[model samples]
Target: MSDALRDRCEELRAVVLELTTTTIEAMGKPSKLADVVTVIGKLRAIGDKGAAGIDNPDYLAWDRVYDASLQKMEDAARRGDAQEAWRAFADQETGVNLIARACTGYPGW
Candidate 1:
């Protein structure tokens, strides 16, 4: 993998986890809702780009999991569903962990 790819992986991980943090912090504060929306948008943009060069099936599997989590999160945010947000975050956390672990099988990983 290129340094760029490695960096992208790290960036994706940070942004995904940031969503969880943003949602948690936004729970009671109406002001933080904007931040949550921003993070979700950022995450969606990153995810929609897909993993360009990575050819691993494991990575793709993780991506699918992450995408589903993102969809769930997006819907939950729209409805202001905190419970579903929590569940989605759990799924995302697992997906992120799987993604990181999957990276270990690659060249520089």
Candidate 2:
């Protein structure tokens, strides 16, 4: 990968980690469902953008996983299931790390 692509991959990973951490922290309080959903939406958008230039199968696979996990997180948040939402968010985080590794040869987490 070029330096630019590797840098983009790192940026994507950082964004994912930040959003996941924020969502997890917000789960401890009530009325944070909207915030969590918003973060997940951002994550989905980021994943879509981040995957656009990649041709690696592993990166693409994990990108899809990240997208699906974001959807699951959003659904769980809507249902007021904090536990499930957290679980999905964790999966999203893992997906992000895997994608970073696949693309940049480093676990950006």
Candidate 3:
């Protein structure tokens, strides 16, 4: 992959990690809505960039996991369960590993 795409992917990974960390930390603990909003914003931004290097099944798996995580997070939010919400979000970050793996086969065009 080109350096720019690699950089973007790295940025996405960092955002996912941060989101997961924050979510885990917020579990059963007080959390600021602003923080959650910011994380969600970051997630949306990264997703909007498109799955440029995500052509492999691994990447597809990551996407599926990500989509599932989002659903769980929304459900938790609806239930007003802060801990569940955080935990689900944190778990979602695991998909980043799949994303990275998929990127390894990118054409880097």
Candidate 4:
């Protein structure tokens, strides 16, 4: 991977980690809803920005998975369904792991 692509992958990984941590920490806490939404939005933005200019099929596939998960999370958030949101976030976390593996040859969790 080029340095820029590697950097973007790292950035996405960090956002995914932070999102996962925050979601777990905020579980059952209504006061943290806004924060979770913000993080989700940030993750989506990162995914959107990084999705362009990738010619690798594996990475592209994983990226699509990530985007789909984000959409599910967003829909759940809009419906005020925290449990579903959490599930979607978990799915997204998997996608993030796959993306990391595809981009950096790291063993996925």
Candidate 5:
């Protein structure tokens, strides 16, 4: 991979890890709209950054999945439903893993 693409991918991978850590930490505490909003912000940032790798299908798919998950989390947070927010967050873990894994296969182009 070119340095730019590799850099973008690595940055995305790091952010994904950060998001996971933030969520896992939140899981140990009382779910707050603030906490969920924090995750939503991170997810938004991730989506923005992931756009750098948009030519890659994995990145594109990650964007799609993450957007959907972000929306779900936002809806729950907006409703002040901790249980639903947590459920949406739990459902998002798979896409989080996909995002991390996606960066590992960036091709040289």
Candidate 6:
């Protein structure tokens, strides 16, 4: 790939990372009411573009991570532990990165 194309991909990755961090930060409050669906929608769009860029399977792994993360967040909410919910949400960012890296064919998982 050309340097320009590689740069564009890096920029997209940065945007995704920023958005993910913002989502996690927004969830810090007890009743923040973060629009998780919207965030997820954006992520899905990114995932689609990323899949094309990487030419690798992404949907299955991405769905697994996304579902598990949401479930963890829901469980925390049900338990009435805002901090735990935020922590879980933040932790899930790791999964997001994993998926992103895998999409780009990062050497190791």
lDDT of each: 0.65, 0.68, 0.60, 0.67, 0.62, 0.51
Against the true structure, candidate 1 reaches a TM-score of 0.66
lDDT of 6 by residue, 30-108 (tens): 4443444445455555544433333333434554466666556556656556566566555634346545544363222
Give the candidates in order of TM-score, highest first: 4, 2, 1, 5, 3, 6
Clashes per model (N, Cα, C within 3 A): 0, 0, 1, 0, 0, 0
Off by over 4 Å in 1: 1-5, 28-31, 56-58, 92-97, 100-109
User: Considering summed lDDT, which 10 consecutive residues are worst modelled in model 3?
Assistant: 100-109
Runs in model 2 lying further than 4 Å from the true structure: 55-58, 92-108
Give per-model TM-scores.
Answer: 0.66, 0.69, 0.60, 0.70, 0.62, 0.42
Worst 10 residues of 5 by lDDT: 92-101
Mind sharing the TM-score for model 5?
A: 0.62
Lowest summed lDDT window (length 10), candidate 4: 100-109
lDDT of 2 by residue, 61-82 (tens): 7766776767887898888887
State how far residue 101 of model 4 sits from its true place (Å). 3.5
What TM-score should be assigned to candidate 4?
Answer: 0.70
Error of 2 at 88 (Å): 0.9
Candidate 5: segments with Cα more than 4 A from true spot = 2-4, 31-33, 49-53, 77-94, 105-109
Clashing pairs in 4: none
Model 4, 7-107: lDDT tens digits are 66667766767777766665777556566788888887877776566666656776767767777776776676777778877653444546655566532
- The clash tally of candidate 2 reads 0
Cα lDDT tens digits for candidate 3, 1-109: 4565566566666676676666655564545434555676677666666666545565556665675666666567556576777666545354345555655644431
Q: lDDT rank, highest first?
A: 2, 4, 1, 5, 3, 6
RMSD of model 2, in Å? 3.3
